[model samples]
Target: MSVSPEAIRSALLARREIALIDVRQEALFALGHPLFAAQIPLQRIALEAPWRIPRQNTPIVVYDDGEGLAEPALHQLRALGYTQADVLEGGLAGWKAAGYELFEDVNSYSKAFGELVEHRRHTPSLPAPDVLALIEEKADIAILDARRFDEYATMSIPGGRSVPGAELVLRAPVAAPDPDTTIIVNCAGRTRSIIGTQSLINAGLPNRIFALRNGTIGWTLAGQALETGRQESVEKGEGSGHDLARERARDVAYRAGVRRIDSADLKGLIADSDRTLYRFDVRQPADFAAGHPAGFRNAPGGQLVQETDHFAPVRGARIVLVDDLGSRADMTASWLAQLGWEVLVLADAFDGPLETGDDGAPPPRGPHGRYKRPYEGTDNREAAMQAYLDWEYGLVAQLERDGTHGFFVI
Candidate 1:
């Protein structure tokens, strides 16, 4: 049976329990999707539905761009024990025809919530020019790229170390042991930067922590130089090879008792949730945009670990992560378990299965969008820069006030 857009809207309005999934590529989903519509592409429906919906009996509605994708997608869902699966009567086109609102943009709700966080929390940040000057002067400031190693390798602020998302929680303190040295976080854009910087401040690190006002994207547009080379890991073990990195990360995960789930286990998880379940494709944004499981949110693993509080918010919520390679998720879930989260790495859920460390192929770099930070533009925007800083400063206290973080920093 097909479900009408109004029916979906009414259910959401009433806060009724249902799982609404948009089976489109991340790029298309980013363009527009219904509020609360978690995206998982059609090709990945069978693997993701159970893990994300976590309630086989919950109403599962899948929609596509009025193309013929939904029917086959629904069939896949039913085959996976999503017995309540149905398609939107006319797909995305029908939702629009019903005059219902559609949300657009990446992390749309999270971005709005981030803005709200800025308003309520009064976070603080360093203006891009000031940060750039620090780099030029050979100052004591440490610039850490809070993106994947590959993304960092593609391009990064000169002298920046690839700390990644989860590693920040483990290594930030070690990066700047002195309270006086500045700690800066950057990604291609704002979300990860904000989340990464705040994670440290929230963890009660005594250092002066700040997110690059925008990120490398902002830096690039300002005509600043980005050095492209191998992603240099600051904290090295016996050796810097992939095997050593994987072993070190696995040790951490095992110490935290992070569990790995197979396809059938995931199917049962989909049968268990009474509340909303979020499955995140914790890979780089561009990788997520290419394709991912249906119902998966595009939260790069590192950022997901760094900003667990802001992203998930729901205490005791079950989260499943999908990665094109196992190491990133494994590394992330380890820290998440220590932070007191119930996280699982869904091995088979990912389409075009992730490379094991054994694959020996280097990680791929993604297209870095050109986004200029407000402070760097011609306006100078002193008020905006200061306001940005003020917002970040407050997150430390917010994390304290809401103490049931349910995060385990592995």
Candidate 2:
């Protein structure tokens, strides 16, 4: 069966559940695609589809930009028992011909939502020079690197400590205990910094907080130096501040419309086989590997927020997060809800020795056709980095014109 672009657009407009799959390599797919079109790449359909689109009868429309991969994808999906699979009539060309917007780059919607957060909430930030001056002056400041630990170790601001996005709420209190200390959050680029900085503000932190404006890209363009092989991490305290952190994060999540549910509620969600559901343990990998509730996959909350489209390509699926500390899940769920997913923090205080082993990392789809992001490497053209920042600044307007992303900043 073939579905029209108009029909796909209508489904999104009405908030109906649909999976818009783009069966092309990540490199080709990243050139441009519909805001909600997930790149499954033809070879990954069998590997990623069953987990990504869990509902066997979920309405799915696969497309390609004249690569002729969509029809084969439809066949593969049907063979795997996806009853409601169909091909997008006219493929990517058809969607464009229908006068719809195509977003560039991966994680487009989440990044756009980050831009919207800055636009609406006026999230505060400091330029690279000011931050550099603070470090040189030895000012009372705490620079928190909000990327993954390995990313922090690779290259980061001087004196910056690794505190990935979701950990900010739980660990910031310990990182900067004094109310007088200034706090700055930085990521390789903008989204996580904006979200991390704003997350603290939303959680009612007394310490002054700012995002490292434009993140490391901005720092590099400003002719500033970065510290490499810095293994410093934010101290996870001995339960002194967790209750307060939990209280604050819960307030933030409540403001962002994230729900807290018990084991009984989880059972209800699991029984609803008609709808797609994802269960995750949003904690540090080590903590998860130590012990975690059975049946929940490890998805470090920080990265999950950054890569939601890849992790949960079924856009409308419900997500349930469990963390030993409820605050982590609440903070994570808050961002997910704002990004337009139905999300809840699973709050069951389970008692027992839980599952432990290697967190089943998702099968790696090889990097054969991965899109090379401009901000990744140490040596990027200044113009490309600046252009990327410029593109992000205009995303709020683009989001308005597209009108499909139901994102709101809290």
Candidate 3:
């Protein structure tokens, strides 16, 4: 069976459940593909198909650049019980022939959506030099690293503490109790920093909040030193701080039209075999391994939002986030809601007995097909870093032309 590019485009615009997969290596997929395409290389089809595309009846459309992989991929998907698998009519060439846009990078649309949020909301930011000056002066400032703790520990700004994106709203108050202290959020690159800073702003944090413009890339470009093996993190405990964060995040999530569901409602959603449901525990990996609600996989809220397509490949699928702390799930759901997802926060479901150990599945592909991200690792070339920032800068314009993204910044 063959599917037309126009048909896929229409389905995307209408927010229908469709999985447009690019059966190519990550490097090639990163070079160019459709705005909503998810890369599940042909070799890893068997490994990824079951979980990534959970619904056997999901409308699956595979494409390749005349690489002879699409048809085989469709067969593999079918063998895996994907009953509705089909190929793009003309592959990548066909998509181009139809005069549609081909986006670059794996998580292209999600990055573009982040740029859209910044463009729409004018998210506040501070350049690296200015932030460095404050640190040198020993000013009242709290630098929260919004990337994962492992990433933060690798290299970070001096005196910066790990508070990952999902933890920002929940723990920022505890990290910087003084409202007079300026809070600066930084990630490895732009997207998480923008989203993290905006999250705090949306939650109505009293402190002056700003994204470290261009994140660690800007800090390096400015000739600033980065700390290695730093162990600082937000103090963990429940108190008035947690209560305030919960209230604030709940307000933001409600404003973004995120639904709050009890266990019964979650069960009903799960029972609806017609729809695809993803249950996630939006907490840190260690915390998730320590204890999380049964049947929910661990997905740190920040990474989940930053890589929504990678995490939830099936577009239009419903997502239910579980978090005992309330703030992480609520804040994460708010962004997903704006990104046009039917997202909900699973409330009070974690009060019962919890399971331990990591239940999440790793990405199917190994090192062979993986594209080396310019923003990660310690040895990125200056040119590559600059090129990455350049790509991000153009996302807003690209998103405008794409026109299918139903993202709304709050």
- Using lDDT as the measure, the top candidate is 3
TM-score of each: 0.61, 0.97, 0.98
List model 2 lDDT by residue over 1-410, tens digit each. Answer: 79999988888877788899999989888788999988888887888898778789899999999977988999999999999999999999999999889888888888999988898899999999999999989999999998989889888998999999999988888999999999999998899999999999999999999999999999999999888899999877757588888999899889989888988888899999788888999888889888899878888888898888887888788899999877889999999999999999888835545898755655676556577777776778889889888888888888998988988777
Worst 10 residues of 1 by lDDT: 356-365
The sequence of per-residue lDDT tens digits that candidate 3 reaches over residues 198-316 is: 99999999999999999999888778878889999987557887898899999999999999999889889989988889889999988999998898988899999998988899998
Candidate that would win on TM-score: 3
Off by over 4 Å in 2: none
lDDT of 1 by residue, 13-127 (tens): 4546556677776667756776557666776666555544555667778889976788888888888887788989988999878766565544444443344444444557776
lDDT of 1 at 259: 82
**Where is the poorest 10-residue window by lDDT in model 3?**
360-369
- Predicted structure 3, TM vs. truth: 0.98
Best-to-worst order by lDDT is 3, 2, 1
- Rank candidates, TM-score, best first: 3, 2, 1
**Prediction 1 global C-alpha lDDT:** 0.64
What CA RMSD would candidate 1 show?
Answer: 9.6
